[model samples]
Target: MKTYNLAFKYRIYPNETQANIINVTFGCTRLVYNRFLAQRKELYETDKKSVTYNTQAKELPLLKLELPFLKEVDSIALQQSLKNLETAYKNFFQKRTAFPKFKSKRSTRKSYNTVSTSNNIRVEGNFLKLPKLGLVKIKLHRAIPQNYVIKSATISQEPNGAYYVSLLTEFQRDIKEVPSDNNIVGLDFAMSELFVSSDNQRADYPRFFRKLEAKLVKAQRELSRKVKFSQNWYKVKLKVAKIHNLIKNSRKDFLHKLSHELVTKYNAIILEDLNMKAMSGVLNFGKSVSDNGWGMFTTMLQYKSMLLGKQVIKIDKWFPSSKTCSSCGNIKDSLSLGERVYNCECGHTMDRDLNASINIREVGRSLLAY
Candidate 1:
């Protein structure tokens, strides 16, 4: 049996009362998380003792007695908050992330988690039954798979004040077999184009941010003119946040569609392992580099490929892909970014990005052969 993890996200509509309850839950969860974080920090500083999940969880009942508002929210949500903090600590010890920090009430992104136990969570018709908030209207965009077991749900409020829930589920399914005689392609990421494929296909960059820069600048300026913490300021802040959200959603949609198309057509995909951090540090190109989201695109490709039983290869960052002649295998002595066309001494010439993609394909084939 092959076990897999799946997440189903959906938009939710909460009434005024439910929304208020959600807000209170968010605040209470934040308070509990910060309190425990402070406790752990003090413990570590004073006696070099590390605080674990069990130790903190044991104190929750006592905490609720003192802070009665915490008891009003779902107990599971409070426990889950502590669990999140513990997970953050684990990540820090493993060097996967920095140390955990206290959550802020003023943060636009607020969320809490709750596990589904004994049918506490369910979807009926067009509503989702959560622990504290009962039967909220939900836009069930897609049906949940029959085999999947709902484990937990993360309720979050976005910057634009839209509410969403991501249901984490688990199931077992057989992995798709990778066909032996399958089409392979290489991808070259560029600023002008999102990607160029070895088969001469080009996906033009959608420049979503550039298109909205003018509107964003105007909105931000208007926001700056408002008095801090005033009603006008709050309204403008939401407007600016909505515009930013639009840009982010558009970019994410485009990337997901492109990655899905590639994974669908090719049995194997190859790409250069670019140092995105170093690329972003370059003076003039930093904004473009960050806006392209190369890292996020690659990550999506990798996970999607894994789910579909497709192969993805990453070549060394130092590989002279643009400098090497795809036809003759001769490495050029000098190549500049300004040279959009690759010219090799062996009388071979082609579009630079296309040529590099072909070289990446060749490298991937060689690696697979071994």
Candidate 2:
């Protein structure tokens, strides 16, 4: 099977012309998204929502027809914006969810007008070729395959004033026989540590946020001293963003490595399908929650399991595994986060995470066997 994959962290340097193209497409995409979101909000608030795609297509030409300049940017982005509105509405109404909120004007709310599929783009020895952008002078630190059907390429600017192109690709792999029944492990997630496994192995959080907390606060204080929208203020803003980005990158590296090891070493892995969105509401990690990388870890583990042909069993969130005693088949009445050790009145004693992990693995194995 040809599966889509992404090659990230590729350095890019777009000349003046390319930069103009990127900016134009990005502005066009943002405008369309904001307009579509406004339309949806008005539809939900009032009753008249006759804005169908066919009508949009017919009406959209009139929008750019007089100006004609807006059409210079990629038309594909406008279509996708309309498609997103349709799909989002369908999902919300079918599931009976609240009307989708309008897109925020905050910078983070914007999506880039990147290529639909980055795999269609390619990097030759000295030059990178994009479908629309053509061959610009590309620097290759490593050799990438010259021939592959390009899908889409998203070129983005980072807070550190560096540019990057994320090319999504597809490739055929020679399937290897999955080594079944190799090793089964269960893992427990926590706040202080990244995870503790059933085999008594533990991976602690790198604590990047904790380490930089003092420095980040100092930077914010300095930033506050600057006048709003001034050059110094913008510089301070970049400083804050850079530090946050550092924390994010560190956490991602740790999570990716940990997930890779777990998936490779164990044939069957058991973990809770943690409701991170819900958990975030209850936990006070400040901005660190976004940088904690728990959600990213689980997402990586899930996909790695599928890609490697391993079994990843998501135990129910309310399965009582944490409060259950693995030694004597006893379930405790209550358990708190402070309890590092589990002591059962039935003469069962074990570490809290260890016991929980054992229960998870046992329950998962039983489920798989059945």
TM-score of each: 0.96, 0.86
lDDT of 2 by residue, 54-167 (tens): 666666677687658768876666676667677777788799666656554345323453454544356666777764566666656655454434555666666655566766
TM-score of 2: 0.86
lDDT of 2 at 27: 72
Per-residue alpha-carbon lDDT of candidate 1 for residues 225-244, written as tens digits (9 for 90 to 100): 99988999999999999999
Q: Per-residue error at 150 for model 2, in Å?
A: 3.2
Residue pairs clashing in model 1 are: none
Report lDDT (Cα) of residue 15, candidate 1.
Answer: 96
lDDT measured at residue 105 in model 2 versus the true structure, 0 to 100: 39
What clash count goes with each model? 0, 11
Q: What do the candidate models score in CA lDDT, each in turn? A: 0.90, 0.73
